[model samples]
Target: MLIAYARSLVYQEQAVRKALLELQNPRRKRAFGGTLTLGEFSLAPHLKTFFQGHPDVDFSLKIDNTKEVMSLLEEGILDFCLVEGLFPKEGYDVVLLKEVPFVLLVSPGHPLAKERKVSLEELFAYPLILREEGSGSRDIVEKALAERGYDIHGFQKIIEIGNISLMKRLTEEALGISFMYEDAARKELAENTLVQVAVKNLHLTREFNFVMMKNHLEKDEILGYAKEFQGFFAKEAGRF
Candidate 1:
């Protein structure tokens, strides 16, 4: 099959490229992409240290939602991506970097903020602030709701936002409650500007993965880099 042949050729290219990197004959360029959450908390913090140790490696990074980043990987626009949402794994190599819990965010003054935990029906009575359709966090929320025999439409009001910071700001202003990873709103939570609403019987977590096309030429090299990023994330989480 032509597809099989192409994959073999790509593997061969990876071998050749690794050899070239070892020789230091020329500067090697690496391309990486990630979803918004990992881009901000994971990749951004590790870059300076990574570059300091591997000066010969020239790299570029792209940040977008999980769907867009995965599309870019399939199209060869990115060598790999750090993803924070649900994706098909059929033809891709994946490294699970981390698993983070999802929580409901609300303003400190919101009525539900004082409650220890709320039932699904009760939580849906308030307005919901959510990331746009293609975002990883949004997809997770949708899936979680479905699993509980509910749908996003159950919310009294829905506010779709593309930016995480804006979503947090809106939540802080009591505009709506948001569902997202806890780390994304840590600073605000620590300051008591926002509070986490516990949903009774709900425990949801999302995975962060380093994903690449199965036959990408830099697969192994990128795997090493991915582990480095994972290490940094682990260290950060330990601090909390």
Candidate 2:
């Protein structure tokens, strides 16, 4: 793709400049972006430990929807991106980091809260609080529903939101049921502010990937962060 080729060229040029800068200063600077879910559950927590180990490294993080973050990557505003939604792999090198469950979330007071599992037909009775278009989680949900011959239109009502934390707060207020990666609501789930509503016959899982432009001069350097994040994620998983 022309876009990919252009991005590759830009990265190569920037790499040369970065190399020159490094010669004058031993400190390194990098920027990373990730989808909201990964930012909340993984990146934010891992960065604390990462900073402790590499005090001289100046790493910055940007959190946004998959589409926006990918745009940042293409513009060279980010060194790499971590995402949980589907993306074009043609021009990018990727690492599959982890697979996490995708689940429906409801407030404890919602009518469906007591159900162990419900059919798709039952869920259509309640309002759906969903991410706005161009979001990775929204795309995943749409694709999964299409496979079952349904769409968001099937819901009684639709509430479009762009913020993950606000979405969870609204869900907690019993405004509507929402769908997201399980880990995104881990804290709320632990506090019983939210509950998972399983859908019968609908099992969904998504992969977290470290994606970067192909032929990156610092591919290994970026991967060092990815590897460290994975280690922290695995250690945290053991406790949960």
Q: What is the C-alpha lDDT of each candidate?
A: 0.83, 0.87
User: Residue 168 in candidate 1 has what lDDT?
Assistant: 92
Best by TM-score: 2
Residue 7, model 1: Cα distance from true site in angstroms: 10
Candidate 1: Cα lDDT at 49: 89
User: Model 1: how far is 25 from its true place, Å?
Assistant: 9.6
Q: Which pairs clash in model 2?
A: none
Q: How many backbone clashes does candidate 1 have?
A: 0
What's model 2's TM-score? 0.92
Write one digit per residue (lDDT tens) for candidate 2, span 100-194: 99999999999999999999889999899999999999999899999999999999999999989999999999999999998889899999999
Instruction: Let me know the TM-score candidate 1 reaches against the reference structure.
Output: 0.88
RMSD of 1: 3.6
* Counted clashes in each candidate structure: 0, 0
TM-score of each: 0.88, 0.92
